[model samples]
Target chain A: MTNAIEVTGLRKAYGSVQAVKGIDFYVERGKLFAFLGPNGAGKSTTIDILCTFLRPDAGTVRIGAYRLGEEDRQIRGMIGAVFQDGLLDPLLTVEENLRLRGGFYDLRGRALTQAVEDIMKQVGVSDLRRRPYGKLSGGQRRRCDIARALVHAPEILFLDEPTTGLDPQTRKSVWQTLHGIQREKGMTVFLTTHYMEEAAAADYVLVMDHGEIAAKGTPSQLKDAYARDKLILVCHDTARTAARLREKGLACTETADTLELPLASTLDALPIIQDLREEIRDFEVIRGTMDDAFLAIAGEAIRE
Target chain B: MMGFALRNLKVFFRDKAAVFFSLLSTFIIIGLYALFLGDVWTSNYEGVPGIRYLMDSWIIAGLLTATSVTATMGAFGIMVEDRGKKVVKDFVVSPLQRRSMVGGYVLSAVTVGVVMSVVTVVLGEVYIVINGGDWLGASELCQVLGLILLSTLTNSAMVFFVVTFFSSTNAFATASTIIGTVIGFLTGIYLPIGSLPETVQWVVKLFPPSHAAALFRQVMMAEPMAEAFATAPAQTADAFREMMGVQLVFGSTEMPAWGSLLVLLATALLFYGLSVVVLSRKAR
Candidate 1:
């Protein structure tokens, strides 16, 4: 597949602090690409540069065939951005907000009205059409923001923490709506999120830390790399078993009543299992998680 | 561009404080003027008769409309709100032309000006007729309307320029009030510019409101433009006439009126260009 977004050696600094330090990544067309990072890890900054809201100090960004700087207008026309903030006017009704956005693309009259109605219905906010935007709940406001972004029918959608501050159920609904749009329109979606579950939903993921890409691959690829082969040992006292195993030169972590150990091979796990049967109440082997991959790559717990 | 302009107008009307204050303030000023000057309308001042005094009432109405509407905090509100909400980023990235965006804002200001002017004219005329003064004829009424429109345009442009370049709403407000008050005093909105000190008269004559007031007085009070020109010294009159001659070359002989409009249009264009440049640089 052709790349939808290509960036090379991107570097951005704020005074003495470096925000994006020579990071590189590419996102394939028509795929949902997730950018995972900590709060100050330059996710928003990179997205800003890509969305034409900020000019990169030094880098090459190519969205489709258009280069960043040289073809910003054309690139901007092809992309729709839902920024971190809800940029809708508080004074305008939901429908009015959409109509005003649609006007930017020269849509007006009956055509504009119909377009707004269709988008609102598609986003499941048609009932709130006449309501002022400030009156809507957080989720409804985000949905309206998304609909406004799509008013111009852009080829790519850039969402910067679209579900931040949302409840779980609302976040799920937003994901579902985004998935529906992607399925129906085949628009490339570039999303930045702190939620691991949201990151797992992407077709590909790029884990960022300290202004650099720590790792990039499919979710399963990352999981397999860090956690595919793992053995879980449940015992009467996990701490005792963990100490005994460590004393015997085995790597293990105790969690409540369970002991987890990274096994080089299933054959290597058999001896430990056989020897520890007396101390173990139960044992099982399982696949790894995206969180484990992130921890392994960033050298820190995902939640922290 | 039409969409932008219409949207701004809709938003302005939806603002309760803006709509209420604009209409309320215009009526309050006219009511106060009528209460104080009701008896004076039937008496003669200088060589002008009582009817002429009543006609000249439109000048006060026009000035009040211009001062109140042009001194509105709407421009600052709009710009500051856009900056705070980051809505300006959307426009900067959109395909909408920069000039069109400025035009939309200016048009919104003009709409407010026109609305306020209409309210003052209607209420002021009602008071004149009810208090035993002759009603204005169609031609005279049209002249008053024209003058009000010109004054509104001029002041709106000035406000637009001030709000565009200054980021601080407080600073804009302070500056607008000082400028508006000074112009009002120097032009003798409550007195006569001819009675001001020579230095103050020179300074006031340079103000758009002074020219605007003079033009309005000429049209509504039936005073000859030449008589209005005499308020300034001979050298100043020559310079003023030459400036008017330039306006005449552009197919308009209403010097003070057209001069204010031209200055307003030019300043609007300049502020708009500067805004675009600043936005572009910041976007980078």
Candidate 2:
């Protein structure tokens, strides 16, 4: 199957600072690809180049078979973008805003009207069609923006932090809408999000840092790669167990009431488990998460 | 492109402040002209000396051109606001051709300019008639109206070119006003370009407004087009015809209306074409 997006040796600079450092990646058709990064990780710059909002200083970007520089007009037709800032006309009603966007794609007459109505329905904003965009709730405006992006039936949608400032319920609604689009139309989605939960929803994730790809894999694969297989032991006699573990030269993290050990193997856990039975009241072992993978790679906490 | 243009027009009309300011500026200039020159307009053309007749026409022409500059702010602001809001981006990525966008914007500017000019001119004429003056004849009125249209078109092209390069509304507004005011004062919109130094006259001659005002002054003061062309130099009938051709090229209405129209068209096309190229390059 053809890739939805392919970037080779992409680089960009702003004056003296390099924003993107020769990064390369391809998004598979119909799959949701999430670009997970910290605040200054170059996600936005990359998205801008792909969306045709900013020119790359070097390299090639191809959306389907269309090259970025050679067939930009054709590439633009197949891609939809939800910019970081909502680009709606505050003076226009929600329906009017959608109608104007449809006009950009040359949709007119009855077809334009139907297209607006259909997208509004899909995004669940049909009732707010007559209200001015400025008066709508933040979530409603976001929904309207999404509906506008989809009005032209673009095959690849680029969403830049789509749920950045939304409340939990609103963010969930946005995620649900995105999921619906992906499932129903099989539209390839490329999104950038700082939210780990949102990143977890992607079929593939690219973790970026310092203008380079730090890691790339499915969410589960990342979790598996970084799994420490650790066990947490909560006990009344933590001092004795901690001393015993320290004497054994095992790596252990101790709290006021518990001692945690990084168990390298199941056998190592069994021996420790057998020795600490009387003092241990509770014990639990769990697999690592994408958050752990991120922390491990970047050596910095993800700014939630 | 039509959709964007029509939408821009709709927004401009919906903006009460923009409409009010455009109309207010036009009327204020016309009112000032009437208060200062009512008697001169009513005086018999036969008794007035030739030079004074020429000067009176020059002043009126400058005022008309100044009015065009004042009224175009609203249209220029609309374009600037659209760019800030990324509305231009939506169009840039679309299949719409660049020429259509330019045509649509120019058309909208012309429509607004024409409407404002008519209202201003009609009110100015009524003020003159009410103050014990006779109404202008049909041919004279046509000539004045043609001057107004041509001057406004030239002003629009100049403003459009400026706004295309300078995206900031404040910058465009400040620069256009400063430039327009300087041109108006130097060309003697309230005085007479002929009364200025030879160096000043040479400078004004290079600008479209100088010729535009000359044409307007000729019609307002009821001077013959031939008499206005005679202000420059003595020459062969063919050389005189070529000078008339230059006036026709820069003049609006009279014998050489098409020339001014072409100048305005060329300026509008060049600036608009540059705007398109800049916008396309900026779009990644």
Candidate 3:
């Protein structure tokens, strides 16, 4: 399948200050692509350029098949976006809001009704269709926003900080709903979020820093490159165990009751554990988390 | 565009406070006239013929013209609120054209202006009859309705232009309140045109809504005006007409009805053009 979005050398500047300085990325069709960054990391600027809300200083951005600048109106019809703030009318019922959004895509008569009904059911908000949007809880409002965005059934969905202010349970459910929609519709979901775990779930993650891509890979690839796997042992002798491991050519950190082995991968911890099995009381291997990878990578970018 | 317009219409009518506040000035005008202005004017013009009918017709005309101004400004609260809540971004990202969005706002504001002003006309006519004045003839009523459409267009265009400068709801609320207060003075509703200083009277006369008021008076007050002046001297009727803003008099000549219509038509076109220019510039 072709790329759902293609942004090449996208450079956008506000007067003298460059917000997105010559960045490039693409999202494959039917894949979840995530951009992870801090507040001023140019994630939003780049997304705005692709969404045709902000014109880039120089770049060729194609949304699905439509060009960003030349075919902006067409691109708009082919994509849906949910920004951080609530944009749906508070006084309007869930169904009314969906009907209004579907109207923008020229859905009317029976087609409009069908689209509204389909979107509500697809986003699992069918039960709340008649409820006023303002009366909904935070999670429910977020679901309505997603439902409104999908009313037109666009091939690509752009979400800016999809779960920024929700509680953990609500965020988890929101992500679950998103995954369901993406799976059922084979939709390309491109989102920018501050949550590392959210980005880890994406098929591809692009870490941005200071208007540039600091790292881009699968979660495990990033963890392998920027973070380490741990091999820990519960033992009685702290001093002798450390010497025995060092003499046998295993590098480890010694503590009062345990020795730690930092290795390239969890697979690398096997041989060390096999060699130290007799002296060790118990051992366990810990895989690095996305947060660990982020600290090791984005932490350096922030410090510099 | 029609969907957006319908949504705006729905939202405006749903907010009961907004609808009432839009007509708050109209109620104030009626209250002032009822409390003391009505008796004071009737007593002051005791010797004149048909004085009650003339003053009633004058206040009714001023109320009709001012409704378009206040109601449309209140209607524009939706536009400013949309901007403040960032709801406009959703429309910007949709397939809806920029012109369509703008047209939706203009259409809805004009609709609200026309709807509210017509209601004012009906209520004003009923008030006149209850005060012992004859109901306007069908032809005159039709003419008044046509005038309502035109004046609403002009008033809404001007209000929409002013609203483009505001985005916050607080700022919009303050602006609508200021506009509501200033509308009476602008249309010579709170006081007659001749009551102001000479230069200030010119400013009121130049005001587009005042011309609308004059046009309304030309139609609604035509019979009563003739009755009031039939027993008086020739210049007396002209003085009363000029004082009460029934006719916009220039330095030496009275402005004909067509002249007021021309002012209103020109004002509508000019404001519409100005609003489009400002909006297009902002888009760029």
- The candidate with the higher TM-score, 1 or 2, is 1
Q: Compared with the true structure, what per-residue lDDT tens digits does model 1 show for residues A1-304?
A: 6789999999899988999999888999999999987778888889888988788889899998899989887887788888888988878999888999889877879988888888898889999999999889999999999998888778889998999999999999988988998889999999998787788889999988889988888988777776457899999877788889999998887777788888765567789989998998889976567776777887774443
Q: How accurate is candidate 3 locally (lDDT)?
A: 0.88
- TM-score for candidate 3, residues paired by index: 0.93
For TM-score, the strongest prediction is: 3
Sorted into a CAPRI-style docking class, model 1 comes out as acceptable
- Selected candidate, larger DockQ, 1 vs 3: 3
Writing each residue's lDDT as its tens digit, candidate 3 over A74-108 gives 99998999999879988888988899889999999
Error of 3 at B35 (Å): 2.8
Alpha carbon lDDT at A21, candidate 2: 98
Worst 10 residues of 2 chain A by lDDT: A262-271
TM-score of each: 0.81, 0.79, 0.93
Docking class of 3: medium
Residues A136-180, model 2: lDDT tens digits? 998998999899899988999989899888999999988898899
With candidate 3 superimposed using the best TM-score fit, by how many Å does residue A258's alpha carbon deviate from the native? 8.0
